[model samples]
Target: MSDEVVENDLIHCIYCNAGTVRFSEADMVSLLEKAREANSALGVTGMLLYEEGSFFQVLEGPAESVDALYEKIFRDKRHRRITKIIRESIEARNFSEWTMGYAGVTRQDLKEIEGLNDFFYTKKCFTELDPGRAKKLLEAFKDGNWRASLR
Candidate 1:
């Protein structure tokens, strides 16, 4: 690949975190609006899923932009116990159509994801999830295998 091609290569980061406080529907709407605006400006694309009081997000963009955004998320007071699950270069964005796609997950929606039985039964927070399982959840969302309400 040319230097320019390599320089423009995309990278993706997947992470999960606990909410400091349970977010209301209004709060989620506001958060998604702001995220979409900011991610659009940064040329980032991703999906965000919230269930109970936990969050799972997949962010893809230029490496610097993704890293910077992840740092900002890491320091955000709204989240706690943040755990990064994946970070690697990608050939292209998996969520290029959305600046920030969002879904509010329910227990029923959790049951639809194949490998998340543990979460369904134990109510484990996303931050406590296994990395491989986290990736599967992301793929499920990407593939429209979820029935969660979207935003």
Candidate 2:
């Protein structure tokens, strides 16, 4: 028998999208370009969903790196009132293949993405968003996106 300890290197974080100026579709696309470049360099992977004027994003990666990235993102002027829905160590990455996945919200997606509708019609500041909801959304996004990528 051997005595060895393995470290947990994974983390998942979800945050609310708040700020005065809402990015247009083109603006968000440009933002995603920058994010993909930066995330690839930092070994980060995640998904960003934008709809109506709100955003729901899940970023996962090395704990330290993900924490750093989230700090920068939280301070970003384009967003505010960030509420962390989840933060825990994990065995694997849900979005291992994506540097930064982008999902521009459509009518059909409204019912699934947790904080979208509240942010859309009720002006919720991600107050009621929970970790379970966030996890489910991220997993579904990851699975569907990966499946589609394979085709």
Candidate 3:
């Protein structure tokens, strides 16, 4: 394949970190807007999970666009301590239609990582999380495993 096609067709998802000023209703709207704007401008797609006072976001798109967006995100003061979780060129987009899908995770959703050191602060752990394991953990949260984590 030609290099142009190779570059444009490559799919990748990268996780990122940011801090929240306040988890208010207005903040939620602004975040959704920011994601949409970023995705539209960069032709990116991905999911965002916000919890506690931190931000955990994923950006998926053509390899080049994703990388560029990541660089921009790193420099933005609205978010800090930027780290890359993973960057693999895949064959398909996991979040195809989402310009910037957003989700707000509560304290309940963070039970798994609560006592596991600073897992959230360390991007490497997120990168190492296989999709299945990540999904299982998330499912546990959704299934009301919040209290169970303390046991």
Candidate 4:
């Protein structure tokens, strides 16, 4: 048998019930580290999004390895409320470089998202949502856009 490895592009979304854990800077570091290990071990590459104290991580890699990694993640004590979004085969990785990336969404930001209709909010979840809606909603906020509001 040879040591050569086969690879494919598969996107995996691992959900986390972040409500149980307190969000902190230390937790951020640990989360990224685990993501890095998972990516390296499974030959996966993708990005992570944490919002409203929830985790939405996307990983792309070999079918078998990615599945195995997913199982491990589900079993990990640090991770709970695991929900595998979709693990279908894809032609390429959406976020082919980052081990993990973090974004902070404030209470006001949550309010903005909530104000959006179901159709618009769902699109923002996985699909490419129209920036117009985001702009409009942000404009409605007293603080303005995310950048300005977050500041």
Candidate 5:
């Protein structure tokens, strides 16, 4: 695959995984702050959703920058069993406004997040979700449906 990142091409990569080590609330906040700063400088836009030690993320931007960030994530020693849900070039971004929008979904919100009921209800034990389904789930959160519908 070409690692070249043409300025005009926008690429998005979505993935999910369970954490190898638990992150405290403070740890999550600090991590998000660092990620937003780094991703902003790199022109990356995405959303990160964490629930019950599992993470679902969608990162979109120049190919080179997204690839570099994924490389670091793969080696972070925190994420385990990473499985990519989708990777493709797109004309636009779903999260163009946020460097890294994030939400830490709680148990009460799980049942109302549309596609994530099983994930949290079942204790985050499962294989990869279908690509389209995964995309919908990400979009739902990115579009503020998760918060509105859940609350």
Candidate 6:
């Protein structure tokens, strides 16, 4: 078989969830480290944003790998009420530069972003956000339009 990835071979998924509890800085660091290692091994690339106790993530890779990873995340006790916002085939990776790029967002940062609803700042999860809004948020992050500290 040819070792090549075509448009149909790739999928991108976006999801959001709330943390079971507030995570300390060290806890976040540890999470990022483990995620980076796991995603790199799976040939996945994505971005993760944490605001308060909520998480918004974008994962892109082979369909099988992405689906498997999403299943693992869905079952993890660290998260609650996981909601998938988008899943679709893509021609190229949106976050190809990072195994898992991350940002610790703040209320002020949310306020600075236009088009996001007021609810985004008060809620601990993004389950209510539509796919269009979620995609806009991801695009803003990808474009470095937000002031959140990213890594």
Clashes of 2: 1
Worst-scoring 10-residue span by lDDT in model 1: 142-151
Alpha-carbon lDDT of model 4: 0.53
Q: For model 1, how does the per-residue alpha-carbon lDDT over 3-32 read when each residue is reduced to its tens digit?
A: 533336689999988655699999989999
- How far residue 89's Cα lies from its native spot in candidate 4, in Å, is 0.7
Q: Model 3 segments beyond 4 Å from truth?
A: 1-8, 18-20, 112-151
Could you tell which candidate, 2 or 3, scores higher by lDDT? 2
Local lDDT at 66 for model 1: 97
What is the Cα-based lDDT of residue 75 in candidate 6? 91
| Runs off by more than 4 Å, candidate 4 | 1-11, 14-18, 107-151
RMSD of 6: 3.5
Regions of model 1 farther than 4 Å from truth = 1-7, 147-149
Worst 10 residues of 3 by lDDT: 142-151
lDDT per residue for candidate 6 within 24-103, as digits (tens), equals: 99999999999999999999999988877888899999999999999999998888888999999988887887899898
Give the root-mean-square deviation of each candidate in angstroms: 3.4, 4.9, 7.9, 9.1, 5.6, 3.5
Model 6 segments more than 4 A misplaced: 1-8, 121-125
Task: Report lDDT (Cα) of residue 1, candidate 1.
Answer: 55
User: Residues 36-107, candidate 4, lDDT per residue (tens digit)?
Assistant: 876776677655545545554555677777787778867877656666545667665544455554455543
Candidate number achieving the greatest TM-score relative to the actual structure: 1
**How far out, in Å, is residue 107 in model 3?**
3.2
Residue 120 alpha-carbon offset, candidate 2, angstroms:
8.5
- For model 1, what is the alpha-carbon lDDT of residue 80? 84
lDDT of 5 by residue, 1-151 (tens): 9764445778999888855567898998899889999999999998887776788788999988998898899788887898887888987777777788887776667556677677657665324567866866866776765634321
Prediction 1 global C-alpha lDDT: 0.83
CA lDDT scores, all candidates in order:
0.83, 0.70, 0.59, 0.53, 0.77, 0.83
Model 5, runs deviating above 4 Å: 1-7, 115-127, 147-151
